[model samples]
Target: MSGAVSWIYLDVGLDTCTQGHDCQHICINNGSSYICKCQGGYVLNADQKTCSRSDACTQGHECQHVCLKNGDSYYCMCHEGYVLNADQNTCSRSNTCAQGHDCQHICVKNGDSHLCTCHDGYVLNGDQKMCSRKNLNLTLTFEMHVVVLIHVLMVMIASICVNSDKSYICMCRVGYVLNPDKKTCSRKKPRSSDTCAQGHDCQHICVSTDDSFVCKCRMGYVLNADQKTCSRKNSDLYKRHDVFATVF
Candidate 1:
């Protein structure tokens, strides 16, 4: 009988707050009794009726990254290589390559910057982010001889060579420059950029010149019309001196 009375006293304390009472906050029915409660960041006044702002963060928050606390105030922060989410509590991986980049082919991270590259059948465009199909025109392998002649004729119109003291000095017209052979001419190359100056796009070998660059193919292969690509050299065709016909 005494134990039952003790249990009743423990379950219901004072038991004064009710629906009709002026709590100025929430009313909680704690078993048979009631208590006045305030929302988050609020504290109940000494009168047990009024509530005031506590200017504080609730204890034991679930911040995904790190929880920052300053006296009674608190916030959340993310670690490196992560970003804070919209809820200001959770975090996400730093999506610089997928969400923040404009690369149309491949995006690779290099130190603090990102590098964009294209696939095998594609070449990087002027923007360096987008890719374009390589200009390997549809033609039979035997027909490259004719294509070579066309490329030579295009070079002929650009510059001319003059004989001086048994040697030759190429006199290039505007926007043209002497080729690696120093006898023919090719179009003036693009301005060497800091990005491109660091490397070349050749598949086999990259050769640097005075004012430009050149791509070379290894043995058993020949440089293609695109000057960067390569194709197998026809040894039988090279043996036939009549294979090449000079273009006028």
Candidate 2:
């Protein structure tokens, strides 16, 4: 017989197909070789055997705020009260009122965003943002009305001024002119004293001239339209006034 001629054949390719083989993600067998692949949000690493996050924000890939990956795509996001800028990666402030800022009179920038504020004689409402008249329920007695009328009459007779808060002051006291403070009276210069010494209430700079003093602002500030106050030149100084009314 030919028993001594019998031989055996081995399938080497099947021996190499061991589930995922040595791949970090998925491995496909091709009889004689294999290949590695990754799932969504990941890509084959440099070694071609492992996977890495595809949305990594490093080097050329960057995000102004945050970057996220989902199924081969990525997106940029910004903090509250901000919206994606024209660049798509950066952010900018959104409309104050649209973002829930309840400003009754004006909305001014606080930092990257804005805040609600009210004009003089107004107070923040229960919402803590909207503004409302503080003394809405105010009532005057007969005697108080009489007194107010008398003060008004005096103001008219003396050529003085009276504010809504019942504040009264002489616009031009005898021999004196209205000072930069508006509440105080200043004497014309060329006299024995210097009116600039009265603290013109000029927030930034004050310069004395021949007869009176001029109110000036610092380098980065501008003289308010009133020509007596100072405000930041880069800020919206002309916006609605947002200070409490006080008696002069």
Candidate 3:
């Protein structure tokens, strides 16, 4: 008899918020338990006990780079080498190098754009950002000559040679992209099936690239410290005017 009584008390228990909860704003009734919910303009955090600001990046916030909240309002911030537009919302690229633009050697401005150049005796890498010592070895020279010949040949074949590293890379022209072979510039279709290797298991989205793949977060979520994981944005940034529950 006690075993049956104990099962009802422990297994199918019911202390579900009948005596109030630690939820900052409100508590919701579940099937056999309860959950905490934040008020409007707020959201519950991963802790499941505290509440933080929500709608931080909504309608009013049109920040170009990042959005920040202060008190009951929100503001915008610009990245380095950028200036806030007159509207105080958007950002525009600035010519000043400052802490922006990853350049290993020197930076030069041409019109509104900038270029990265290496010092003498150094050559720009494939990324056009870092620099390395120029390799003028005979073998490398022969490769360059071979690259030129291949480029000319590609032009005759309705293709283009954009890379000279090791051998070449077929730079597909507009309305065209490289086929699975990475050599044939096939006409671009409306959409292509995701061919990412099985077991990619990205949280939200996975984008395939020439070299590898990129993982991206979904809307209303931000990439966490671990690039593969995601978390609700503004969930921990609320302070002023936001009454949060303390886990005492």
Candidate 4:
């Protein structure tokens, strides 16, 4: 029996070992040979049939903050108050107010931007970059003597201050022209040919004057409530039509 060939072995004709035998991850079959492969986040063990944990934070990893090992790969993640940068390999401050904030009073940090806020007794202006006085109503809550004293003090502080029914008017700078409303500067002298060039909203004609312009309508039309637009007169429109009435 020692020199004799063993005929007790039977061939099943199926290559199960070469197909997927003992592969913990993937099995690659090459004819009568086979190779085992591990999925992402796993490495082929020394036995070549099982898989082991792959260190995601090892060399060749490019995570910004934390490198999390998933089922078959790894992902980059950021920590609190930080976000992955554009390159995805570094972290930067997520607050938007970290950069150049132009807020006049307060700069509230947001997720990726900032908000402007005014302090007490101040309100944000139309431009939102500056603050203005909060109590613009001009109603006097103090005694008459106090009001008079305040007005006197304000006038004393400003040499060119002038009070009017509507509002206070300030003196214009040299070579600058005051507007018709008498509150703000309109333009400079050596004016252009057209005085209404900037804010003339006339629907028909704008007549230039010494310092400003007057809005005028055509011959057949009259000025509307806006004083800059023209409308057909009711008298002229009704004159062309005959009126009739019926009593029920």
* Sort by TM-score, top down from the best: 2, 4, 3, 1
lDDT of 1 by residue, 106-224 (tens): 89876445789988767788988999865444322333444346457775576554444323355667888777865556778776544336687877878777656889999989899
Instruction: Provide the lowest-lDDT 10-residue window in model 3.
Output: 239-248
| Candidate 4 lDDT tens digits, 1-248 | 56977676534565655544779988876455677899876889899989988866663578868887664567788887787888867898787666568888888986666788888657788887788765434533344235346447655332244444433445655655566654344436586777877678789999988878888998868998887999876774555553422221
Count of steric clashes across candidates, in order: 0, 0, 0, 1
Model 4 off-target regions past 4 Å?
1-41, 44-49, 52-55, 58-60, 70-72, 97-115, 119-133, 137-167, 170-248
lDDT score of residue 215 within candidate 1: 90
Candidate 1 achieves a global lDDT of: 0.70
Two-way TM-score contest, 3 vs 4, winner: 4
TM-score of each: 0.28, 0.35, 0.30, 0.32
The TM-score measured for candidate 2 stands at 0.35
Go through the candidates in order and give each one's C-alpha lDDT: 0.70, 0.65, 0.70, 0.69
Candidate No. with top TM-score: 2
Q: Which residue runs of candidate 3 sit more than 4 Å off their true CA positions?
A: 1-15, 55-61, 93-248
Off by over 4 Å in 2: 1-60, 93-98, 112-114, 119-248
Q: Output the lDDT of residue 212, model 2.
A: 74
Score candidate 3 by TM-score against the native.
Answer: 0.30
The sequence of per-residue lDDT tens digits that candidate 3 reaches over residues 1-248 is 55544343444556677757788888887767789988877878898978988756664677889888865568898987678989989998877565367889998875556789999768899998899977544334554466557558666344555545444565666877767766556666654355456446568887776545667889868877666777777854554325544532
